[model samples]
Structure formats: C-alpha cells, structure tokens
Target: MQRGYFFSAEGGEGAGKSSIVSRLSEYLDSRGLEIITSREPGGIAIAEQIRSVILDKENTEMDGRTEALLYAAARRQHYVEKIVPTLNEGKSIICDRFIDSSLAYQGHARGLGIDKVLSINEFAIEDVFPDLTIYLDIDPEVGLRRINENADREINRLDLESLAFHRKVREGYLELVRRFPARIVKINANQKMDEVFEDVKQVFDRFLVSMGKLS
Candidate 1:
C-alpha cells in the first residue's frame, strides 16, 4: 500500500551511497520515522545468491545480457521479499541502488542498450519506481581513485572494468537525468563526504516537505 515514501540513491563507485543511506536512515529514525535501509543486487537471501553470481570475478565469460538478466532476477526477489512488504507496512525505505544502476552499468556501459536493459527491469519493478532518486555526481576518475584506496572493499566483476566503461556509466546517468528530470536530483559528490551528505539531507528534507511529512 506504500504508506511511506521510497527513496533511491544512485551513483558510480566510491560515491558514498552506502554511508549516505545509513546516515539518512538514522536521521529518520531519530525523527520518529520508520525507515528501512537496503541495497540492490542482494537485499535478501535469494537475491544475495544471485548477486554473488553476477559479481563473481571468476565469471569472466558471463555475457552482457546474462548479467542484465541476473540483476533483474535479483531485483524481483528483493522487491517481493523485502521492499514491497516494507512499504506496504508503512515504513519508509532508502535503497542504496536500484534499477538505475543496471541502466547505466549493463545497459549503457556494457553496450547492452539502455532501452533494452530498462525494458527488462520494467518487468521486475513493475512501474513502482522510486518517489525520489538522488544521484551523487562525481567525475569517474575521482570516484575510481577513491575506490582504489579502499583495500577492504569487495572487488566485484564490475570493479575490474576499464576506466572507459565507468565513464560511460557516468554518461548513462546523465542521460537518465534528461529522461526523468523531475524524479532524479543531481548532487555534487566531488566535495568532502560530509558536504555530500548535507546536500542529501537538504534534498530529502524537500521531499518530506512535499509529502507533508514536514511543516
């Protein structure tokens, strides 16, 4: 029934989406809001298994269309098992990534075609798009540099892609802004992490205001 709002955060690697989502969920909790924070490709058990297959560096022979399909399969499980039920139960959700990642990574960067990837995702998400999508915009080089500094970070198949592919991912996001201008908000993430989160807060505050959750 979606008694509360859904917020999805989008960005390239090292854009600090996980940290931002955690902080926002904590803030909402402090404000007496029931907020659930999650991430895509593996939010629950079934989806986590699918995520592993998609991210495995050993799966170098995986086809582009296969990768996209795996993502869609995981997404559908996550939504049905976690997201939809949480929203229906009247809890707000903040997802670290969503269909937008596929549109950028598999669709555009992998040369699978944005429209093709989007069409595949449509069957899973079923038009229940995020009420708000906050995109953290940073140059691909800068973002990749940050990723390189994190040794503890899990190295996925996508992380091993050439810098050129990541740049295309960024371009794909920009194209998405043009496609869904009203729903996607761009934020400069080149600054300090705290600065980025402050911008996230402001954007979320506006959404809450619009929904009459704030005065």
Candidate 2:
C-alpha cells in the first residue's frame, strides 16, 4: 500500500488556519479517503504538554533558542508517536501546522536564522516532510484584528506579540512560499471564509486529480 500524503497548513496569527483545516478535512472525508487531522506541538500527549509550555502567556522569559528547541522537541515526539504511524496505515493526514511554522516564527521572526532552524527541525523530523502545504496569506494587521474580535479564540503568548513581530512572521511564511513553490500553495485569506475555502478546495481538487484519485 502506498504511504499516504501529509499536508500542512501554515500562516500568521488569525489567518483562519483552523477553519480551513476543518473544511478541508471534511471535504477529503466526503470523497471516501481515509484521512486524519493533527496539529504540530500538540498532536500527541507529550507534544501537547510541550505546547502548553511554549504557548503559556506567562512564559515571556523564554529565550529565543529555547523556544525553537521546545518546538523541535514537540515536533519530534509528534512525528514518532502520531504522524509516522498514521502514514504507515496508508491514511492521508492534514496537519494544522508543521515545521514551516518553526522556520517562519523561530527562524525569521526570532532572528535565529532559517537555515539554523531548518537544521534543528531536520534532526527532529528525520527528513519526513509535508507533501503539500496550504498557506493562508493574510495581512498581519487584519489577521490580528480578527484575533482580537474573536473572544472565543484562545489568546496564546504569541498572540500577545507586537504587530511588528506578526508582520515578520508573515514575511517569513511568504519567503517559504517563494522557496518551495511546488510544495507550498498560497491562498488569499483576506476575503470571506467561504471564498477562501473555495480557493483552497480548487487547489486540493487539482492535487487529487494529479494523483489520479479523482477523474
């Protein structure tokens, strides 16, 4: 049996990543595909524990390199405990976030250097990479506004970051898209959620067709 495809969604804060992941998962499920959805830094129990430390608003004293390492550690645990097993079962998976988030947030925004962060993640993930990444492109200001207006959304430590920091994160993600055009597809996320989902659906449909999973 063929190993299933691994897809990740990436973006800055409040880019509608969770919503998109949910819609995409449902769409794939309706097509009779065996699939699952997971998130980085918190998919499995161990990783979820790490996620709490990383996102805890009171942990403002966390060093930049330390933050990067924590993320890499969580990723390693998640990959071994959850992701690898799922793919081995021939079941496709959609992850809410993945290594790219590290490269963007810790790498670019934290001034740790993308290449350095990539090396850390390489050791953590052991070369397993996403087959495709759907990036929700949105203006940092607009995205943060959405976050502020959504009272139900959990405000993590990252959400408390300055606008300048979020801007840097978006810049980092855009750089990743430029570096990995074939693996990363950009979707305009400034529009209504329905419109954004349609754009994402088209990209997903084309991918299925290319794999001969659709007519």
* Structure candidate 2, residue pairs in collision: none
Which runs in model 1 stand beyond 4 Å of their true positions? none
- Where does model 2 exceed 4 Å of error? none
What TM-score do all the candidates reach, one by one? 0.97, 0.99
* Model 2 lDDT per residue over 112-192, tens place: 999999999999999889999999999999999999999999999999999999999999999999999999999999999
Whole-model lDDT values for every prediction: 0.90, 0.95
Best by lDDT: 2
Error of 2 at 7 (Å): 0.6
lDDT of 2: 0.95
| TM-score (C-alpha, index-matched) for candidate 1 | 0.97
* Shift of residue 121 alpha carbon in model 1, Å: 0.8
Worst 10 residues of 1 by lDDT: 1-10
